[model samples]
Every structure is written in structure tokens, then in C-alpha cells.
Target: MIKFLSALIFSLLIPLSASAAEYSDGNGYTTIKTPVRTSDPNKIEVTEIFWYGCPHCYSLEPLVQAWKKDLPSDVDFKYLPAVFGRGWLAHAKAFYVADLLGMEDKIRADLFNAIHVERRNLNSEDALARFFADYGVNEDDFRKQYDSFAVNSRLSQADAKIRAYGARGVPGIIVNGKYLVSAESANGNENIFKVVDFLIEQERQK
Candidate 1:
């Protein structure tokens, strides 16, 4: 009887030892990592895959911004616009155009607001040109880059990256090229960042 009890206790403690890291959330949406820590040999890259037309992505933007502001110096954070389908591809083009024109900071959030908040249909180059003109971007220059091979190629690459990430939906995050942190995770979006921080610390320890 004593031996059996000791074996049972050991089995229970084994699982607990593997999941020793803890995270806090005032609400119920918080998750921790599993035992097998996933790591990448390259720099710690944190990429957020989102689409401008996604309301959830829009809602998460502020939280993402906060995270970016407080991100550690060692972390490399990037925003990769996702082209999940025909509807999302246009926004992806706009994102690349902004990137090529060196106007991503000025226009990325506005594009999101235009789609989700303002209910504007910027689904075509003509519409996008009008939108850019309103924002003081020269219409011709915007059109040139919008139709440029560079922008188109980058958009293609973005689409490929989105597919490679196996993103079932928008507003998903990929950490260090391996661990995927999605809202589907037990902790949800808020906990995703916590998991990321934990992973970064784990890497530092190594």
C-alpha cells in the first residue's frame, strides 16, 4: 500500500514539474507553456500576422502597440500583413505599397480604421489611390508603387509567409520561428504575449 501511494504521487508530480512556469491574468484567459521548450537558432523574431479588414485584429492593435513599446531590446518585432483570401489580398497590397513608399507608419493604422471602423471599401487600386491622396500622398507616386513589381513581389512573399505559418485566422503571432501563439491557445491574446516573454527569458537562460 505504501509503495503504490508513493508511485501515484510521483506520477502526479512529474506533470507539475514540466509545467512549473506560471503567468497571471485578472481574468480567466491565461495559459502557460508545455514542457518541451521550442527554440530557434536565429534572433528572437516575433511576428504578428494580421489583416486590415479584421475587426479582431483592429481591436488587438492597441495591445500590440503597447507590447511593441515595452519589447526588450533583444527582441525583433515585425508586423506581417496577412493575405488570407481574395478580400484580404487587397489590403496586403496596400501594406506593401506603404512599405515601399516608406509610409507604413503613417498609413497602416489608418487602413485598418478605414476598413473596420469607418466601413470604407478600399478594395481596389483606384479606391486606394483616393485614400492615399486624402492623406497627402501624391496619387501618381502611390499608383506607381501600388502597381510596381517590387510591391507585388513583396505581397506575394507575404502571402507565402502567411500560408507557411499555417494561420487559420488573423491576429495570430509567431514567436522565434517555431512556437505559434494564437487566440486558440488556452491563454488567448493577452496570454500570448506572456508566453512570448517567458520564451524569451528561457532563451536568455540558455
Candidate 2:
């Protein structure tokens, strides 16, 4: 159910067309008309909004991980699950649930591999519970947290941010809440960080 729904939403809404790699405004990156304020006014925030079921996102995951490894002390990095539909909403909720349980980092890579590599059907609650059980999280406890207020509240916040971003695709990168980058804008998945580095410096100089 979720798999089909998410794919439908993704295909219908996201424009995957590649743009010129001018490495400048409107080419490699786009300026958000209305900048969404960053969570921290002091640090430069780089947020990557993605979906687990997105192949492009999964491909870029390794690059994202490598890029963020040596982030400067003044820069803050975050990940927000993209919510395009109920299917996405379920994944978003699961993200927060994993965070709340202190298993986000541990489960992040495996979850992606489960869907993309292992080809597992993790589109349902029971499926996710079974997956979590491998990490020692009981099925009932996992479900309880999956439906908890904390996760839902985080989902609401993410949904609002997604709307604010006007994002039409996954593996979207937002720099300081002012500039947006994606494979479409950045020419390709590999060049995303190049444009992001430019934007980060651009913000730093301001």
C-alpha cells in the first residue's frame, strides 16, 4: 500500500529533469523566495530532506554521509524525512520514533538497505515492527512509540517544513534555510555537494 502510494506521489509531483550546471543561482542551486528561519540562529544549518524509498536518495546517501563527516564547528547538519503522502508520513513518523528510541543512527543505513538492497516489504506497521525487533526493540514497544505523541508532533513539524520548502523531489538539500539544491538543480547527484559547498560559503560570508 505505502510502496505504491509513495511511488505514485513521487512520480506525479517531483520534477526530475536535469538543469544546466552553471554552479550559480537558478542552475546548481535556487534561492528560496521566502527563507525559512533556521532552528539555530547562530550556526549555519544544512538540512537534507529525503525518502527511504527513493532510489536517488539512497544513491546520494553515501555522498551525504561523506560530506557531513567533516562539517565545521559553525555548521549544523540535520535530516528530515520527506512527507509527500501518508506513505511518506509513515516513514517520517518512523524516523522520529527511531530517534526517540535512540536508534536513529544505528537503523538509518540498514533501513535503506532493507528496502533498496534487501528488497524487503517494510511498508506496513507489522513489517517495521519485525525489522525493529532485530535491534532488540519489542514489537509492542515499537508500535507504542510509533504512535506516540512525540513522533506525531515531529511529523506535523516536518510536513509544515516540506510545504515551506516547495520541494518537489527527494535528496533535497537546504542550506541555511535560504538556498535549495537537488539533483535537478545541481546537474546530477554527484554535484549536489559542490553546489551545497558554494551555498555554505556564500552564507558564511554574509
User: Candidate 2: worst 10 consecutive residues by lDDT?
Assistant: 13-22
Estimate, for each residue in 1-206, the C-alpha lDDT of model 2 and write its tens digit. Answer: 99999999888665532322336778788888899989999999999999888899999999989998989998999999987755676677778889999989999999999999999988778888999999999999999999988888888888788778878779899999888999999889999998988777777888
Going through the candidates in the order shown, the clash numbers are: 0, 0
Off by over 4 Å in 2: 1-22
In lDDT terms, which candidate is top? 2
Q: After superposition, how far is residue 55 of candidate 1 from its true place, in Å?
A: 0.8
Query: How many residue pairs of model 2 clash at the backbone?
Result: 0
TM-score of each: 0.78, 0.87
lDDT of 1 by residue, 1-206 (tens): 99999999999998877664453232222222332222334567788888888887888888888889988877888888887678777788788888777888898788888888799999888898999898788989888887789988888777766666666777877766555566666356666677667666765676
